[model samples]
Target: MNPLLPIRHFVPDTEARVMPDGRLYLYGSYDISRETTYCSDILHVFSTDDLVHWTDHGAALRSQDIPWASEGHLLYAPDCIYQDGTYYLYFCMTGSYEGVAISDSPAGPFHHPVPITPADRDSIDPAVFIDTDGQAYYFWGQFHLRGSKLNPDMITLDVSTLNTCIIDEKNHGFHEGISIRKRNGIYYLLYTDISRGKATCISYAMSDSPLGPYKKGGVIIDNINCDPNTWNNHGCMAEYKGQWYVFYHRSSQNSKFNRRVCIEPIFFDERGYIAEVPMTSQGAEPPLSAGVPISAALACQMMHGLFISPAADNTTEILSHATNGSWAAYRYLSFDAPKSFSITAAAAINGGTVEIWADSLLLGSCLVTPTGGWDIYRTFRCPLTPVTGVKTLYLVFRGNDLKRRLMDVKEFCFYGDCGSGNAD
Candidate 1:
């Protein structure tokens, strides 16, 4: 079976919530008008039984009625939670502050927006978590992190326990895209740290109480197979068939416009802490699945590369590229028939190209282009020529102007055969 065949496309800026009935509902922002690109509105009610296919229920919310937002400003990064027979949708308007809408049904003609918290403070990406003790807490912030207690109704803040600083330290504040999950009596607060760039690192804080003096932990997820300068944040975690996974987005090859969702496995340590997730590009061994066709999101996670860029001094670092930028490879297996290979790239240089060679025979090259937005995803394919002996595939990024940055590759796939080879 083709590896890429199983991946399904999802609308951008979408967050998912699973109903008690086992149906998955998605809420997100939609780019309705092409003129400004930012003229996006909130789209509600998309559902899927299996992750591979999705059904759209049309716009559940739109910009036509929002009085506080300007015409061109779009709604973004919506999150939802169900409580007391009501689904509360929390979303950011104009990328400034978060508001909420209430609906009786999962797919809703939601009520008009109501401010959960005042807009005087900078806030976005509000995630509401109901802890084991049945207390609701709100977490949000872009550059500065903040959290607070929510009323039992989950619509407005309690105010009695007003805003609390979970991790408000300067240079350490990354309060966007937050999710709180409790496993085995330990509460894990998962959030994205964007100080590193468009590349988001997933870190967690653990505590005995939902609203806490939580202790911060190491990074659980970091960029793999994409540029650190590219955006890859805002995701949700889910468990399917007993495996824990995270669904998140990454900026396409161009590093700006196209953002695609990918999935990766989440592992836990013996002490219940998450293990250090290896960067993509250091190709991982195929997920154990009895060889069934897995979703492209999962496959992409398994084969993502590491983000390598010019250091602060603008000096290029020549490290062997690994799958997800962590695992070194001496051999690779193909996913398609005819033994093919491909490399896709986006960069800011002229006359720059990436060359792929196997056993001294040229396999393929992808030319860099500027017209392609800094966030374009491009794929170049090359058919592998049959050879009787050993084969070694090598990749090199070459550019005429050293000052011009090279390309950031998400990851490449080899198909058809596992030729005998070894890395020297």
Candidate 2:
């Protein structure tokens, strides 16, 4: 599966940090199904070593675990950092109050969440950055970018040193979702802005100091097309294994609340200007080869009436909700000749076919027969038209009843020699 595909349900507001043990750990707000609320009082942490496979470190911290947090408070965006063998988790609740938690491990059952922000200063999206000189800074805000020097305990902010208006949003395009990271001694402040359009776009600002009277950079990511109905964008940046990645979210299930995390590689120019990172289907991982099982959730684009959900076996099921024109596509496949492919699915509808297309040309298709139940599984095989080189693969579902589902497709794979000795 593509690393960008959410492990389960909507896990938005991603904050990625490469921990001391060299694994990339992800902490994000967990949404319940397709609810409009931010989160369901708990957060899960996921860690990946190779960027291809990830392990879910379930229930890192729950709102009930925090004593001072308001009752039934929704856990919003959170950030975790390792300092002195302890993990410090900075988080926000529905009331927009900031809190800090402590854990002995990176992926943790974090405990002891204490409110850090003052009662008068209500804000969300907390980001903490530690400088090279061993000084730690805390940031949180919406329209006005704010920060303060943290006490050595990392649980308390130096309220006397708080700068409530560090960067003016009117000049810098900072609306919300602040993330701080340093590269080459330049402090980069990445945040969500509505300067380009109504949709939240990830913009950046750079300065030489942690407390930045920073200069506005440019948009690192734009969420206008992330989803047809994308409402906002939230993300963070991290450099892993000599490569830089921008982590963001995309709305799914035809709702803005069901946003999923996504990532794409980014690069810096010689002048240290970070390039604009565009959203892609082939996230973080390298281009997929022919034999790798392409998860339906990783479909480059789904049009007509297609959707995805988690299925058994850790796979994503592509739901063909009626409409013969409905199609899902996987980008960039290498083929040598007329190769055979197989689809794993279960269809309750009879005589439906998954028409395959290489690039724009129609290939063959796999017949989907009635399996009694949608959960009943079957493997359908078919051959494609002779093709060579690289091209995008499109699977269009054909059936009657424009309002009914066709089948539940788990995955598809090409097994024959389709060129290329190795694929990443």
Q: Native-vs-model 2 lDDT?
A: 0.76
Residues 62-163 of candidate 2 have per-residue lDDT tens digits of 888877766888788999999999999988888776888888999998987788856213888899999998889999988897898988988778888888
Candidate 2 RMSD to the correct structure = 5.1
Q: For residues 1-424, write the lDDT of model 1, one tens digit per residue.
A: 1111112222444565778778777665543311224325656567766554666676777765566666755676777888888888887777585678888878887777777765323667677777766788877766555677888767777666655566643545354667777778887777776555543676777888776667776677665444423454666665554566655555432233344444556888878788755433212234222112211222222223433322223222222122211222222223222245554444433425556555466656545444254444355555654333333334556666554445554445555222122210
Indicate the worst ten consecutive residues by lDDT in candidate 2.
415-424
lDDT of candidate 2 at residue 94, scale 0 to 100 = 82
lDDT score, residue 299, model 1?
24
User: Model 2: what TM-score?
Assistant: 0.81
On lDDT, the candidate that comes out on top is 2
lDDT of 1: 0.54
Error of 2 at 207 (Å): 2.2
